[model samples]
Target: MDQAAAGMQGAHRAPVCYRHPDRETGVRCTRCERPICPECMVSASVGFQCPACVRGGSDTGPAPAASRPRTIAGGTVTADPRLLTKVLIGVNLAVFLAQLAVGSSLTDRFELIGQAQFSLFSPVQGVAEGQYYRLLTAMFLHSPTNYTHILFNMLSLWWIGGPLEAALGRARYLALYFVSGLAGSALTYMVADPRLPSLGASGAIFGLFGATGVLMRRLNYDLRPLVALLVINLIITFTPGFNISWEAHIGGLVAGVAVGYAMVHAPRERRTVIQYGACAVVLAVVVVLTLVRTAQLT
Candidate 1:
């Protein structure tokens, strides 16, 4: 100690705070053992520590947890509002189960057979009647005989619905979904055989794919994966034995892309207004086409 003091006297030097280098300090951090000044000191287990050492943590420590995740009334987590997606999946499952209960009768009634003779379940035999609801209901129906149809559709729903719903929010997402389906049905109603029935959410799912691509492009993300997906699905749809509805896919994809584009291009200042307008335009076109097509379905 005397020798050190003699050396210090010769040079006029002492240990200094690591953080505040201008201030001379006799104290060192307990954790890092770095010299520290009063201003830089933080209370520690054994002794005072430098502020940096406290921030860095010691062998036995990590900073305390930050504030807890927030929740809303009814214990809903406010961080993500994916409620719409869940409701959609639930409804699809419920409808699928109902199909199972009704057996062969379900597909016969709900499948889109555009100008087929109508009953209570499908009450418009001719375009003269307003059985336009058939176009919408057809989206919810799937082949009761082919389990894979509903399986793949629902899986796609669970996979894609969450992200899309989150991006678009509840109302817009629902609009996209129903409109996409209606577009597919509208096209199917016009182009497909009135005798050959079609069913499934593939059309709506295709709409999501198109919407995803447009939104991605707007957000400046890579779109090759989606493009590849579109190609693959189209190939599957057209493959001879697949017996998929290419008409629905085309209609839904077109509608979804249109909606997605408008949503993407909308000005941030009035995004909601423009989005609603875009949806209205898309729906108006689909409805008018349906009316015109139904009128011609003689």
Candidate 2:
């Protein structure tokens, strides 16, 4: 008799969702305790809630601005506060301002001049004699004659940098920047006209391009647009009007793609270790090339 009574009670107690009267549901809103269907439910910090209760709840807050993404120039940037990108831009801006403050002296010192100007620095030494810093600092210096130069580089940096920095973290991104820039300088050292002096962040920015391309390709994105952009930039670099360093662009792009590939494809367990190791190997190669170029010069 007791079991029969219990069964009868259970059978009569079945509840149907308020939103959909025909469908049975046991889930209740955490806040209102009202039965809700899956379509009517909203996930909250505490538990599932009815849409009405969620709308009325005082505890919920808006999505964080820090993680929000925005589009600027040709790249996507998040509010996630990438310190490396800010620092790079700030340093570049400071150097640009300082260039305006002084004049040709800064350029003469930091610019990656061709072998002719390099030979004048020291005839008896390898590595351009006392001017090795140019390999790194030249990325910061630009054509002080053209404001457009710094503007475009900075824009490109802001566009491509935030995502890479976020994905690679601060240290690796910094390493990527310098390695690509140095490789560009190395190539410039080898291929640039001995009479020409080149300076700009094109190589570093192009490094971002290559890295972004690698990341995108890893995620199975089409590489056609990237290739097109590369071709267009190459054309722009050698277009006969603007004094551009195709060597830096090419070198940086290749290095970026290489390093970026290594970074994205590393074993998940030792991702950072392998990525850093790859950078080390690439930088070692750049150093070796520099030494060889210096040997040829001397």
Candidate 3:
């Protein structure tokens, strides 16, 4: 009877996870035999291990190459994948607010225009006059007069940017975005009327669209939905009354596809080099187009 009571007391005092002192757990690290909760468990050949054991060699050492978590584009896995996307949206919204407060004062300096003098006495202002930053700033600006311009673009960015950020990771995703936006800006400068101004997140969003298409293809997802959406957007872009910049759309889409393809398909051994090399190539195209347009305008 005394032995039975002792056994009962021992059972009540069952081990708790070392890492989570408050939680009781039957699981233990296979290597270290330390009690571990589910959250601390890492799959091992024989059984689960604690995170410390999974790190290999020592409790505080770096994980082995085989053990490190990686994203589809070889970026480190992060807790919050959509952080950068949210930041980009916030920046666009903030810029739009500035446009509202300041009007053409902000728009005139940032919107992509080849070259123009607003009035007879006004100083010549444009990329041709060395306001080259317009190519970048233009991607974040939207039509303050048209609410739907920012609305639709922001929605698209939220929807597409989140998943793409997760897949490509932050650095690669940023590279894809800037390169695609610049591609759009360059193409718009190359072909559109010099006196006309163009600005929007459409180019960057379209780049995300193309990248999303490539990612879907890589994952063997349903392509029909993406195709239908692309067709609809293309129709809207070319519609006579809309006055959308088709050059930006086409440029962003092409750049997105090219960069995204490299991001997802590059061999693991040479992934970083190949992925960034593709971005550099597209950026070169943007620079070339910009230079040619500037030469012509001047």
Which tens-of-lDDT digit does each residue in 34-97 have in candidate 3?
9865445554544556767656646565678787645567776556878999999999999999
Q: Model 2, 161-214: lDDT tens per residue?
A: 976776565667788898899889889987777467888999988988999888
lDDT of 1 by residue, 29-89 (tens): 7667887654444444345555345445432334333321111000112235568777877
Best by lDDT: 3
Count backbone overlaps in model 3. Answer: 0
The clash tally of candidate 1 reads: 0
**Comparing 1 and 3 on lDDT, the stronger one:** 3
Off by over 4 Å in 2: 1-79, 116-127, 222-225
**What is the Cα-based TM-score of model 2?**
0.69
Candidate 2 backbone overlaps, count: 0
Task: In angstroms, give how far residue 192 of model 1 lies from its true place.
Answer: 0.8
RMSD of each: 16.9, 15.0, 10.9
Greater-TM-score candidate between 2 and 3: 3
